[model samples]
Target: MHCQPDYKHEVYIWLKSNQMCLLCDEATHSAATLCNTCEIDLPWLTDGCEVCALPLPISGLVCGQCQRSPPAFRQVVAPWTYGFPLDSLISRFKHQGRWPLGQMLASLLRQCLQDRFDNAELARPDRLLPVPMAAKRLRQRGYNQAAMLARWLSRDLDLPLDEHLLLRPHDTVAQQQLDAKQRQRNLLKAFALAPGAQVQGQHLALVDDVLTTGATAHSMARLLMQAGARQVDVYCLARTPKPGT
Candidate 1:
């Protein structure tokens, strides 16, 4: 005869699937790593430029910068503006080597991408390219934050990840320490495509944790297009708003 489920086993299963908020001890009512309250309160972007996803006064309007000179990447899909607790969490994950926070943030980004897809705000692409880390930085940090996020997205989205296809030939000074003009100059000729790789007529999605000055993503996209990728889109977790916006 079939037997009834064990009461203690049922409780264990429920507890395992129901996760507490990462920010607090309260139950999140589901398997989500973050609670609804925290997720909603995060710095979500509203009005923005389509090309670079820069914050603008109105939606569907191109920013002055993009109008004058468009970036190589076609569009940017970023859900949150970089600030507050999200910034602090990313800082810890990136600087302190806290892997759990990185994982949690990746999961949240997957959810955000799903929401955008559902609402027709974004489109799916053929491949995901995690931004390459310089060898020195990789050796020091023990991980690439972009690659870590790409790993999670690869599974969640069931998309192919070209994590190793892009290579950084030269290590430039930190982009954070430079102004936008300096960032652009520093990133010139910084990325190279591996020989024998084929991306002709393919839609590539560049994955990164954040977009600061847009120089790095633009540089990578230019290289991809020059190498014959049909289209390039950016999928980043966060974007810093324009100063004085």
Candidate 2:
């Protein structure tokens, strides 16, 4: 009797979880690690600004901010709102080096992007460009999160990735802590085109892990257009909710 420690259920649960829902650590039959239940419950963006993808109360309409001064990009597409679990997961993925979390987010983005294509919400871009990171940041982080996401998207969408075209000349102060004006000024001349990299008339989509305040995306889009890109569209994992939303 002392030899039987009742470990049967624990072993069964562990085996089931390995083959099942990664979110709740429960048994399931889904091929994806994240079960349908968890996916459905994620803070999926329902309505957002047409131009910037900022979470909004209405759909199919541009927000006041975009109207006042439109973004350089033609459109922005983000699947989820940056809140709760997504925020925590992104934090772990970006800062804590949790690759699986990034992979899960990228897989979900692929599915969401398909739905967008089916609904004709977005058109396939000619090329994908991950937001450039400074050399120092890249070395410090060991990987650029945007580039990783873009690589995943390239495989999923069969789109070519052109990271060589864009270059960050220097590391600017983090944009999160700055106001809109300061963020814009901080990024001035921070990005530059690689010598002889052609972008004329190319419809490019810039990819990143998150869109906060739209400052960085706008800056990048502007740079692309200045280099003769016909259009730039933004793709991100999540869009931070409008302040106080």
Candidate 3:
């Protein structure tokens, strides 16, 4: 028999509260799907560049890349480095259509961001903007993971979201398949702002599932900045460590 949406939601919540840890298979004993021990053990990005969030030898130091040429965004905020189970989980969520995994990660990211907001470590954005996907790619994926993340974040954070403000009108090479330079080249002139969108003096956050090279974030942030956005920041679940680190 089919269940109503509300009933399904209630069931989902019930399962969540009684869930096993996604990694360790222990009873979570909490609303979170991850047990505290396993959660703490996840590849947390403890010390990183103040601007780009690249894992660093010490806290509060800028990576040389960012020092020489800062990104268009003010900062990148992520909870973990792209490693181990997070890499596996993100791959499954993005390519295999396991949205629950994405939802779980997004929930954790929300908690992390909330703590930062409480501590004044990072200022919240005026709106959440999911990096747009090309139409062909969106059709193949069925749902844009970035958009899903943004929607979940918007609801939980009580932040406004503008899905239509950014547009990826043309398809580019899959970013994961390219080197940083190639990825940058692939995205050249690949993104566009929606006509009549008002970004002037606004602080924006670009939401995505993972940040590998920062190529896409840079491209999108540049687009928004050129349109007079006051500030742009990236919010993602994971940040890849520096290449070969």
Candidate 4:
């Protein structure tokens, strides 16, 4: 059996009840100030590439890289660009054992989805799939941050969360250090649909904590397509803006 974090649900409930900020862990002043930390230090992504959500020139819809070679996922949605307080929060949630932050991240993601789908004509997914981590990495982390966020998102969106639909078969090298081409190469064959997991004719949304090179999400998207998923949307908390843009 996979090792599940003990306080995942508990922390989520606490955040819902306490009215604390997701970013700062203090009392929230208003709907605008959902959390204390978000008020003063909220890292916002004002200008981002439409295709991958990477920070870009405010006027362009797609980044040069994305235009040259599009990714497999249909669209990417992220509340903030990876930077400052957002980066610190992600680090805490993933590495420092702060599971409550997952709830906060999910809350933001939920809001972003509402905003995106409200005035747009996009179809919502039938199910949510968290990008699976390798078994070895899952053991070391004790929990998959993507899974945690997906659980909360599933509840918020009234969609089913499919935890076993995809598996990360190989532990690929980190994408942070790799260029776009190298990143894609490293993630090839890193993911596969689990045996007997049927996604035929289903619209699936892939959730993750961050979108860096888009390599992992693209790999997962390819696997889902092979499993007969009708469509795949990528959702994440943060998008690391391409450097210098």
Q: Model 4: per-residue lDDT, tens digit, 117-184? A: 78684578989999998999889878888888998898887878999888988998878789988998
Give TM-scores for every candidate, taking all chains together and pairing residue i with residue i. 0.89, 0.90, 0.93, 0.88
Candidate 2 on 1-245: residue-level lDDT in tens? Answer: 12112333543454445466656877666446677788888899999999898888878889999999998999988999998778888988798776667777988898888788789967888999999888877777777888878887898888899977889999989888898899989989898889998899999999999998888888889988988999999999999987776
Task: For model 1, name the residue pairs that clash.
Answer: none
Comparing 1 and 3 by TM-score, which wins? 3
The candidate 2 region of ten consecutive residues with least summed lDDT is 1-10
Range of the 10 consecutive residues with the lowest summed lDDT in candidate 3: 1-10
Instruction: In model 1, state the lDDT of residue 240.
Output: 93
Candidate 2 error regions (>4 Å)? 1-20
Writing each residue's lDDT as its tens digit, candidate 3 over 154-213 gives 998999999989999999888989987899999999999988999999999999988887
Q: By TM-score, who's the top model here?
A: 3
**Candidate 1 residue runs with Cα over 4 Å from true position:** 1-19
Best of the two (1, 4) by lDDT: 1
- Report, for every candidate in turn, its global Cα lDDT versus the true structure: 0.84, 0.84, 0.88, 0.80
Cα lDDT for residue 188, model 2? 90
